[model samples]
Target chain A: MSLLEFLDYSGVAVFAATGALAASRKELDLIGFLFLAAVTGIGGGTLRDLILGQAPVFWVMRPTYVVVCVAMGVLVFFTAHLFESRYRLLVWLDAIGLSAYCVMGAAKGLAATASPTVAIVTGTMTAAFGGILRDILANEPSVLLRPEIYVTAALSGAALFTLSSEMGAPLWLASLAGAILAFGVRGGALAFGWTFPPYKARPGRHPDDVM
Target chain B: MSLLEFLDYSGVAVFAATGALAASRKELDLIGFLFLAAVTGIGGGTLRDLILGQAPVFWVMRPTYVVVCVAMGVLVFFTAHLFESRYRLLVWLDAIGLSAYCVMGAAKGLAATASPTVAIVTGTMTAAFGGILRDILANEPSVLLRPEIYVTAALSGAALFTLSSEMGAPLWLASLAGAILAFGVRGGALAFGWTFPPYKARPGRHPDDVM
Candidate 1:
């Protein structure tokens, strides 16, 4: 398989494992594990495809994605207890997946002739939306609501990838640069508990007045 | 515009209003209200188009849908406090929109030559997924978890629409029957607090063992 294709599938598998781990935390059944895994594996790509007007979503075109996700789900279900800290693994794997997906999504957006801004948006969405859906489905507070700079990391990577693509960099080279930036930022955050400045409440601002 | 077009736009407007109402409850700013409104107005149709491999989602092609949603958002922002019980209006408007969306989605599915079961599923998704997205984004307890039989109502309407279409019923006739069924069921639930039987939790079923 090509590098892009391999990275895409690895991302799917890793995300599926994270989803299964989440299901285990919720004490959900096997069906819940499979459902969450499939949704987490494919949700971002599905949304990106729809927004880009790309017909027959990636997984629908290649059934192997579904098979890989299901396999990951089953594996996680059987071996979740083996890991001493599943949450840590989930975070690290998710960071890797996010980095890879950002580059891939930006590549697809560029190929689709989307404008630079839209391409970056697509990449960010592709990288982060699956996790958003996973959190929502598992009834956890979405990471979006947290102070963590998660979406910002995805956005930066996407912007870098789009810029590199526009500068005529080779696909692999551009993707590599973007992925490194994303992973580095996310990895740093994981290690150091990095976060954005919290939004301070405006004492006199009425909720309706802000509009 | 044709009758279907009219109902579709009406559904979008109503859904957008409901989303704005939700945003008001969250004490979000103006942008949040508009964002939620747009998401609720188009989320279901976007999902349906993606699944059906329909390129360039319905709103992207028409543009009017977004305009309508924004307008509704602005209107709701100004008039949110005029109504003493916004929740009641939200539910009734949501029911109306759900019924209209079901018939419209089913018609599109059948026109795309989807199987009856697929058409029904598409209809149900189109009717309910927008509200699901809205609730998730607003961090509300989703209607899906409520005692009111919302999804079941959508599914029943979609099934009836698909069945009637397969039987060579005219579009108007089939749509009317489907819409009536959906609204009736939803309206009854609203009036009488109807609900499906809760699933009984089985003891001794390990979360991982079911796989």
Candidate 2:
């Protein structure tokens, strides 16, 4: 398989594993785990394809992505308890998937729409939206609402990759750089508890008056 | 405008209003209201079109739907306090949108795929998914997990429309019947507090052993 394709599949598997771990925390049945895994694995890509008008979305076209997700769900179901901290594992696995998916999504967006702005937006969305869906479904606090630098990391990777490709960098080099940068940012956040400042209401104005 | 087009726009407007009400409860700004309104209004049809392989999506092609949603957001932002019970209004408006959209979605599904089964499923999804997206984004409890007969109402309308149309009924008659049935079921639930039974675990099998 091509490097890009390999990264795409790996991202799917890792994201699916994180989703299954969430189901384990919820104490859901096997079907719930499989459902969450599939949705979390493919949700972002599906939204990207819909927005970009890519018919018969990637999972519908290949089916192997879903197979990988289900396999991960089943595997995680039996072995989740073996991990000392499932939440920690979930975070790290999600970081890997986010790093891989951001670059892959950017590449697909560039190829499909040939618009750098769209590429960057789609790339960030592709990396983050699956987790958003997973959290919503599992009734967990969304990563988007957390003060962490999760989406910022994805956005940085996408922007960097898009800029590098536009500057005539080799595809492989751009992809590797983007992935590493994303992972590094996320790792920093996890290890050091890095966070963005929360939004603050103006001192004198009413909350409803901001609009 | 044709009847179907009228219903479709009404559905968008009503659903958008519901979304704006959700934002109001959260004390969000104007931008948040607009974002939630737009997503809740168009999310379901977008999903249906994507699954049916309709390119460019409905809102992307027409743009009027989004305009309507923005208008609703602005209106609701200024006037939400007028209502004594915003939640009650939101539920009623949602029911109206659900009834109209279920029939319209089924018609589109039937026209696009010419398969009754796909029509039924797509119709139910189209009616229900927008609300699901709205709840998730607003951090509210999803209607899907509730015992209330929300999805079943949508499903009944979709199934009724598909069945009637397939039986050589006139388009207008089938659409009206289907919509009324959906509204009736939802109204009954609202007025009488009707709900479906929750799933029961087996006497001895553990939750994890269900698989």
Which lDDT value does model 1 have at B60? Answer: 53
Interface root mean square deviation per prediction? 7.2, 7.0
Task: Score chain A of each prediction against the true chain A by TM-score and list the results.
Answer: 0.93, 0.94
Error of 2 at A177 (Å): 18
Could you give candidate 2's per-residue lDDT for residues A159-211 as a string of tens digits?
89999999999988889899999999988989998875433333443333310
Could you say which candidate leads in lDDT?
A: 2
Model 1 CAPRI quality:
incorrect
Off by over 4 Å in 1: A1-10, A13-17, A20-43, A46-89, A110-124, A136-140, A144-211, B1-3, B9-39, B50-93, B114-121, B136-140, B144-211
Q: What lDDT would each prediction earn against the true structure?
A: 0.81, 0.85
- Residue B195 displacement in candidate 1 (angstroms): 8.2
Residue pairs that clash (backbone atoms under 3 angstroms), model 2 = none
Report the number of backbone clashes for model 1. 0
